[model samples]
Target: MSSSRRVRPLTALALAASAVGTLLVTAPTASAGDYAGACIRSVGSRTSPNGWLIPARNFQAGSSGTCVREIQFDIAATIGLDPADAPGFIDGAFGPKTDRYVREFQSRSHLEPDGIVGPRTWEALISRTTD
Candidate 1:
């Protein structure tokens, strides 16, 4: 997917508003469990336009950036991509290294690998139900 299509956590509030009718957004709580549960519910149940589950691992306040980073790590790890051998920082910034990780993930997943976290890519990331 193109970079324009990627949903940056910085813009989550806006992006989420776009999902008004079809998607459900739970009240933001301090608990990670709340976020995790909500994420699983939101991403697992719905299929994006690209037929993939939009990623739910990101969108937390302080951890939004970290959420994306964790996603890059988890997805790449799950798919056996290169750099899967490496550990991610779990910081929320899309730095050069994170960009590389994302590209690698995209390639492994057979997506465009543009390093953008769009609905299509997110769909692929959340394909499996979260525990």
Candidate 2:
């Protein structure tokens, strides 16, 4: 014996619509406090000086640059991690400490627990700054 399953056109449409609705309902939305009062500094002509622009490449362990420095500062500030306690804080180096903090932040934000600082993580960090 063979079993066959068939979906009516109306049922298919309803299922698609329901899926879309669910996505819309569960989608994350930035709140007023997210980016309204966030202070992102500008570096010359760079549109995103504070590393707001998603980098061409993912920032992982060992990545170092001005953008990395900006990301470090933002992540530290977002997670309320004091930079004063640590020497060379926000030094633009993605080290173990930074990875740990990033993971912690990601966990808190319900993001993937990967240590790489990508666009989604950056958005979550940048948009969550308090005035």
Candidate 3:
């Protein structure tokens, strides 16, 4: 096999090993625009084509910003929360409502259901969200 082919698997492994937080000074992704309390993460490309915006640290009930918005969108989508009915579902605020939904998503995915969107939750959410 060519060197590039050998590198691809290693690149994927490194990407998976990447932690939840790494500061990226560039602009945030499209789906998740800059927001108050937003965390600039380098979990993925800044271009943003409908993926989770994981933060530089664990996000819980008090976090808000681009990362939270991505989480809200993914979790709500996977858990079947209608945006019209639950406005907070994707409000970009990690409030009580979002935390509740996170736990639900986690439980369904067989995670710890801690309501904390760390590396495990991020991976699970990203894999589960096909849309």
Number of clashing pairs per prediction, in order: 4, 1, 1
Best candidate per lDDT, number? 3
Instruction: Estimate, for each residue in 1-131, the C-alpha lDDT of model 1 and write its tens digit.
Output: 66577668869877667777435465443333343344556555445776654544333223344345546445544554444535544444566666666677668779887777666666665553244
- For each candidate, what TM-score against the reference? 0.46, 0.54, 0.57
* Candidate 2 positional error at 89, Å: 1.5
Least accurate stretch of 10 residues (summed lDDT) in model 3?
41-50
Quote the lDDT for 58 in model 1.
31
lDDT of 3: 0.68
Scored by TM-score, the top model is 3
> How do all the candidates rank in terms of lDDT, highest first?
3, 2, 1
Q: Using TM-score as the measure, name the better of candidate 1 and candidate 3.
A: 3
For model 2, state the Cα shift of residue 58 in Å: 1.2
lDDT, each prediction: 0.54, 0.67, 0.68
Model 2: lDDT of residue 2: 54
